[model samples]
Target: MQETLEFPDLLRLIDERSTAFLAAVAAAPSLDAMVPTCPEWTLFDLVEHMGTGRRSWAATVAAGPRATAKVEAEGAPAVPREREALLAWMAESTRQLLDALREAGPDRGCWVWWGDSQSPATCGAVARHQLQQFAVHTYDAQLTAGDPRPLTEDVALDGVEEFLVTCCATTSAWPHEPATIDYHATEGRSWRVRLSADGARIARLPATTTDEADATGTGTAGELVLAFYDRIPLDSLELAGDRLVFDRIVAWEPE
Candidate 1:
């Protein structure tokens, strides 16, 4: 895996991108317009989800495992119908989350549902996770507004690594038998992901010539990251070798 971003850097990214996301929400022509990428949600629903999710994560950071139940409780805060009110509420909730994360510091223990238990439950992990969440949702918001912008190469590359380790490797939900596929980012990073009946494993490959594996996907880091999340289709990527292998891997849903 690539080296993770420092906690402070991740926090900065969350702040920057989330501000942009809220701006998109503010500028949306109609809150009722459907988000094409997230077909089930309207713009209003998306903003509400993002805001409430921040609050839940903030609670988790502040209270550790004990906050899980409270975060999951029914009747989470509702998004205001008025756009200005919704924006203000989102801003306040985001600040609460940022404050909680900052007070906890990078090394402070917190609760994380994904990845190995042995992995440190630090505020740094929370920041990193939230950065990706904010970045992807920002794209969703922009795409909804017909102004899609790619994430920066650095954030996209790190997001690819985080998705593999935190989401893929830690789950037993991949139903496929043993297989390997390589993902090559145009920014010049590549990863080999191995999926088996047991689970998944991922490794960063050296930037040297090597034989192609069962499948290979070449794209910008941002494209790869979005495709990995299924926010974008696999065909958005340039694929070589077995398309089926790549499709199966991407199709796997975490349990």
Candidate 2:
């Protein structure tokens, strides 16, 4: 399994990306502008989700390791209707989350959705996943505001692994024909993912490989990660083999 990012580094990203997300929303032409990636959501809805999500996760982390409460029951405040108030809520929610994460530190046991995966149920796990949450939603915010930017290489690469570990490669059965797909990032990283009725497995490929796959996707790290998150089209990548396998794997979400 790939290592989780250093606790401090993950926290730093959470802060920076959340700030970027808020900045994007604050500068948006209109809060009502629809997000292209999330066809059903407006910029306002996106910000509200970000704010309340942070709030809910904060409560979960604060509950410590043995806690079993669902995140949705954390009593996060509803979004304020006013523009300034909504932005303020988002900012405060972020601050509280950061505070909670710092207090818990990296190894402290905490509630996390991916406890069964290689990632432990700890404050660090929450921080890692939340960083991706901010990173991806920031793109949503930027896209809504018409100022989208590519994710940093470090964030993008980490996100790709996180998505696979947390969202894919799960105990849940695949319930589809067996297939293998390869993802190659221009920066030299690669992952070979296998899916079967049993479940899914992912292996990090060597710097060079001769083995073939049912489907292959090649792109820069940013593009590959964004495509995995469905933030961008898979067609944007150089693809080979069964495109349907690529589509199914990308669309699969952990229950």
Candidate 3:
């Protein structure tokens, strides 16, 4: 089973990363400036998305396990237009999420969208998934501000698994032939992903596992995570074997 960070640890990172994102927003050239990564969004839009989404998730957690959570899209309050008010709203959004998580605790069951396939119905899973979103969007904010920073090694490592479970693994059938891809991190961690009509299956490779995969990608943990999120191109990693299959897997998205 994939082990996620402890609940408290996840909370800590979420706070740190969200704070960083807010700081980037504060220092950004303009709220109207376009985000290169998310072309459809401005800095204001980005903040609204994160803040509002966090509030929605907070409601989900507070509702307890298996409860139908309220959604912001369903007549929620509008986001503030002013920078200072928006920042304060975002901060409060984070605080609410943190407060909800703390009260529910990790083991408490929660209604998560991933179902039982990618994650368990627990608040801990919500925290981990939220961390990934914060990490990625934080990078988006930084990149938009022309001040991108590297992800912490630990977050990047966990992010790979998180991305696979939450985004890559799906019940949809793969149209292409079966293949295996190996990811080797400079830090000695490695994972092997088998792609087939059965969908994508990922497992941490045993030390004895052979290196002869149909496609192999090598890079630092951070680079791999960034590439998975499309913050960086696949070519940034050293690759070998079937480029076509690798590209196909990289481009795969759930319906």
Best candidate (score: lDDT): 3
lDDT of 2 by residue, 42-136 (tens): 99889888887888887778778768863652555668988889989999999989998999998898877665565667788788889999999
lDDT of each: 0.81, 0.83, 0.85
Which ranges in model 1 have alpha carbons more than 4 Å from their true place? Answer: 65-78, 117-120, 171-175, 209-211, 253-255
For 1-255, candidate 1 gives per-residue lDDT tens digits of: 447788788888889998999888877789998998887999999988998889888877888645544354235566689989999989977898899899888887776877462235677877887889999999999988888889987789889887777776754745776788888999888888877765677888898857668888889999988998788888999988888887777566757
TM-score of each: 0.90, 0.90, 0.92
Q: What's the CA RMSD for each of the models? A: 2.5, 2.2, 2.1
Worst 10 residues of 1 by lDDT: 65-74
Segments in model 2 whose C-alpha atoms lie over 4 Å from true places:
72-78, 250-255
- Which ranking of candidates, highest lDDT first? 3, 2, 1
Please identify model 3 stretches exceeding 4 Å from their true place: 68-70, 73-77, 251-255
Across residues 1-255, which tens digit of lDDT does each residue of candidate 3 receive?
Answer: 455588899999999999999999998999998988887899999999999899989888888865865444345567899999899999989998999999999999988777635667788888988998999999999988889998888888888777767666666767789898888888878887888878777778876885689999999888888898888989999999999998787567645
Clash count for candidate 2 is 0
